[model samples]
Target: MLPTLRSLMRQRELALHLLTPEDALPAGALDAAIEWVHSSDLDDPTPFLSAGQVLLSTGTQFEAAPGAESVFAYVQRLRDVGVAGLGFGTEVVRAGTPDALLDACLQIGLPLFEVPYRTPFIAVARAASDMAAEERFARRSWSLGAQRAIAIAALRPDGLSASLEELSRQLGHWVALFNANGALDRVFPAGALAASQPAGPAAAAGADGLVDTVRREATRLLRRGQRASSTITAGGETLTLQTLGRREQLRGVLALGGSSELDQAGNEVVTAVIALAGLALEQNHSLDRARGQIRAAVLRALRHGDLALATSVSDGLWGELPAEPVRCAVVETRGGQLDAVTEHLEALVVEHPGRLFFAVDDGRLVLCLGEDGLPLLTELCSAFALRAGLSEPGAYSDLDRAMAQAEQALARAGDAVGVSEFGEIARDGVLSYLTTTDAGAIGRSVLQPLSEHDAAQHSELLRTLRLWLEQNGQLDATAQLLGVHRHTVRARIAQIEKLLGRDLSGFQERAELWAALLVAAE
Candidate 1:
């Protein structure tokens, strides 16, 4: 904290005297913070002075006996530039303090103090400079200490949430975190704020509105699908909202709220917290990827009839596997919503333990839940606007066949966002037969050219062809589902036909291509 004018006058060695009457002082004048002390003899020194500075002079710029109007003008100019106070050097260019100058300061509410000749202007400047330097040092030390505390908090078991709590504690303000779906994940000092109690600067502002506003901003940022930050005032307090993780894979949002604006030191502490939060989120993402791989491995074991291996791997980590007579469901999203949906599912899996199991396979989210958990599957699909294909309940040994059933059901859903059941569309037909191992190998060979082109050029030709087939060769529907122009869909289909050396317009060729797609999917 810088020394105010009242504090400066208390320095006995300087022999400073307050000329402004104690009773006549303006509001906050006694505690007016002085940023620095400067000396000048120029008539108009306001141009060189900044706000909150205390200007000292020897009265050299004034006439021998300046008039009241001239004195008032000088005082007004200083006040206009936000000078904290004026210090006149007595007995230097004059025998004593000028009456006109004193009168003008008193009338204009500008603080006026006297500087004795024994005290050089440099002495006042040095004192103010030393105080500012000490303040800077103290702030820097506090920032470093706060950053260390936040870092330590991030190492806790609940690292991400713990770091946020520490930041709120260090700043003496409220902090909240929101997941990518704009759902409130955690809040520090969780409750209503009371002004009389003084629970940090933002305590005066109600926490209810604070949280609502933060979540609203979080949603807006997520919808924008970009990495950015915004600051807003909620219930008379300032709140900062920042996006976490990369732009394409946003993890969540972090919000801090307080009545007063953060100083540079406080900002540095917040910046460190943001960085640590991001690191924790990225670490969790990596961990989630590893977990997904393990889940996928478990699923593969079940498909290969290795129940023992699957049970051993999943037993302690995710609870026991679902009992026999389990149903399989494969989910697919349009695009860009996969990360948010995956996060939601992860939370559910943690909350429910072994109630269900899930994994990411071939760009689709796959799940195996007990027959009783079927309602949850529907809820998930509806909530996330996803398309899902479900198979009838079967023993663990029949998982491979069940997967084909689910894939067939999903194919029946076409380009719509809803659930499709294998039992509803099952038939003893070519489609069902094509989903076998021998058929899959032939299908892969048939689409090998398109697959190679996609892998080498990083193109979406394969995806386009799949969607076109799903839409039953309808260009408009395929374009709408892919979020592209109809002409582009037509061109891709034309290119597919050329690569396959088959007329896509023919029913036999279309059926063959569709079967190949189903085989590859299984």
Candidate 2:
């Protein structure tokens, strides 16, 4: 809030008159803070003048036939050095203001003022300095007030959201909060802030594209876990991204949009918000860990067939379990990537509002999800390339049995199939229980006689028997599948029954042959 050119002009006691037209001055130059003021008669005073200062000169050096070009060069140099404006002293050295300097100031868009001889140069400098000090003190006071307000908001019932709301008000910008996973958790000003252009179809499309780009950049910055700030131009507005947390443990990010770069006071407020947000995130994480421990205990109690204890613990943490049957799933990562899989599942669970209990046990992830969450759990497993086994839907009382079934199904899941269900394994019966070596042995033993017979006699009996079994021992259907007549199929089945010394009509024999066929195919 240092004194600006316009503010100095308003001080009648200083007798400052703007030589340059108000409209001709550079945009924001009048409102720009004047760091200090200095007087110099030396040519090329730019070396001594700093940025954001009003340079006062008596044109003493210009008395010696100073040309317009020289005046232009001097003003250009002062402008290049970021001098806030040029103040030419009148009624001394040279009467009134010279035409060359006035033209030069107008051409360069630099603010120029005339200081009457009645007003000493020291007066203007002292005034600017005093105003700057006053503004500094005011800003400091305002910053302290904002910080205290934000801190109090953080202690309110709504906590972080209230703090964010206060921050948005102080900043005059939209604020958005993102979780650790880079997902947007909340936004201040709600839906009022949108990325969009003024009008036209092309502008609309461009706005959409820019919004997507900003979101991608924000997410990337959050995941990178670096304390950084970036300005993104989107929808004709500037958006700034700021990471919240300590250097070692990045917990979340804050996105501020619809505003320009923050000033000193604004930056101080942002720092406070970042610190508070970090503490809030840390507290939330600690709470989540405690809840997870409670959930783990509940899972263990359920596994031990202690339903009442499990129910009590679960109710205390995540409310009541679903009244409907719930399915238990056991998931195992392919490459010992438990952390990645667990994070993925946890994110999915957050999206699903229903009750879910999950924890890592014995190097595998176990979950008892609500029946409605089955599809999402399945999707998460498949997306993460995790091998999973799911048990049938069962009540909380049947938790132990469901877990056992899920584990058995997980063991049955071979490399070919990524996921297996208890019902599928149960349907496979004893064949599903066989290991690779055992199934191979059983397959060779049951089919070796027919295979040898076919090899020795060059008959199609094995193929015919497989087709017949696959067709559920239907003569006409098997014949059609084999592209042969029903009579030929019947003859082949009779030869197979005689060669195996077993009646194909018996259910036990048919079951055994079917199992052998399945094992051999595998």
Candidate 3:
């Protein structure tokens, strides 16, 4: 096992004294053996530690009394400062050491290590340095062992999950595989890592998002779906991430819990791990493709004749091919910021695997099938828009639908448009009616009059006409919709027909007028 706080302490021969109110600061508190002193004075002191430097200090700079009157405030202050540990340093600060300080340290739950005045601070510092060196050596050896393990994993006849679990154990970390959408599919951790994490599929959100971001970038680097990797933070964890290739792509993110610091060496190891993941993913994809091909062939044959193969497609990397019902919802970006849109989709998928989601051709978003209700698509659109920092979600359905809706909603929502859940916009007017009609050109022509009018006055005539038309020529309904009497509806209709020089009773004529009314509303 890699060296830990317990092991390092043992090797250093540092007096093992449990911190308690009864405990006194051992004679080593002021010794130069201690490599560094931590003030725990607001913000962080990690910058001062360089690398491998042991830090010592008294807890006074961090906490105060631990009673109800001052407990939370005292602990909060110390946590905010982020001290290594408090060392009384003999006569420097507090006479010997305050019981309150030790109590506070225990209550705050920060790691507290005792220092003895007899032990020279320099010797302590040296011990820390030596321990760090030893750790580095051990890390290198483990990395080499991991390299060898990867080689062995490459040859494993087991499934991807099994091989990866062993690899994670060798690396002493938790490894997770994310899909293009950022959903957690597989997780392999060493020993207690899985138990420490919420890995049993209770809605993978935080970890899923981290893996998704990394996988997406990795995919861009190695399009083969078999070569990709990225690193990101999610759930307050430092994740050294990477991805696999396009064929058998694995959007995997690896995280080791001991240290938050990331070095060039760690990055190299992460890169190598990613390279190995790429190989595995490529192999997985090829195997999947072969399996998919055979299944598809049989399904197609069955479809033509009789056997019933499930209509739904697997969430495989082959684009929900030949089976699943995939719809392309185009999300428009500013100039060329498609990657942001992809990120939004990824954020959504970790919670709801509603669809096989992907960004297509940069300007558009595509979704596979939804596991929940059809309305989830609407909610998802709302969420994606909101996360993208948009305010009100507009009619974001397909590329044509969402783009058009977003364009219109964006005007009012401004940046808030995408942020709002557009599916709940209460769209029950001309806009809603127009959604069903592909009446693109004629509708615009009908609304041109209103555009000409908006340039002049914000008149009620056009508005009344739009309301009446949306009510489907029903005088009573139009009256209700427009908050006017039934007679007002008839009168407005007469004026509108006379103004346009056409009777609006026939279906064709009604369609044209309705289109025009919609144009004006927009």
Q: How does residue 395 of candidate 3 score in lDDT?
A: 20
Q: How are the candidates ranked when ordered by TM-score, highest leading? A: 2, 1, 3
User: In model 2, which runs have C-alpha deviations exceeding 4 angstroms?
Assistant: 191-247, 329-391, 404-466, 472-477, 485-522
Tens digits of per-residue lDDT, candidate 3, 1-522, equal 222334435654666344543224323322212333333333344545432233465435534533543544554454454433343443344455555555565666544556666655556556656665766787787677766666666666654555567656665566666544443455676333335446656545544554555455444544444543345564455565554544453443333332254544455555666677666666655664465455444334333533233223433333332222323233445432343344444445554554434334333333333333234445655654432212132222232444444334433344442333244344555455454445556666765655565557765666676666677678898778778889877876786677677787878887777665554344
lDDT (CA) for every model shown?
A: 0.84, 0.80, 0.49
Task: Indicate the TM-score of model 1.
Answer: 0.65
Off by over 4 Å in 1: 6-33, 90-109, 114-120, 176-235, 241-254, 323-332, 371-394, 398-522
TM-scores for every candidate against the unseen true structure: 0.65, 0.76, 0.39
Rank candidates, lDDT, best first.
Answer: 1, 2, 3
lDDT per residue as tens, model 2, 203-281:
6667556556666777788667677778787765778778877765677778887746777987899888988888887
By lDDT, the best candidate is 1
For 371-456, candidate 1 gives per-residue lDDT tens digits of 76777788888888899999999988888788888988887777778788888775546676556447888888999999998999
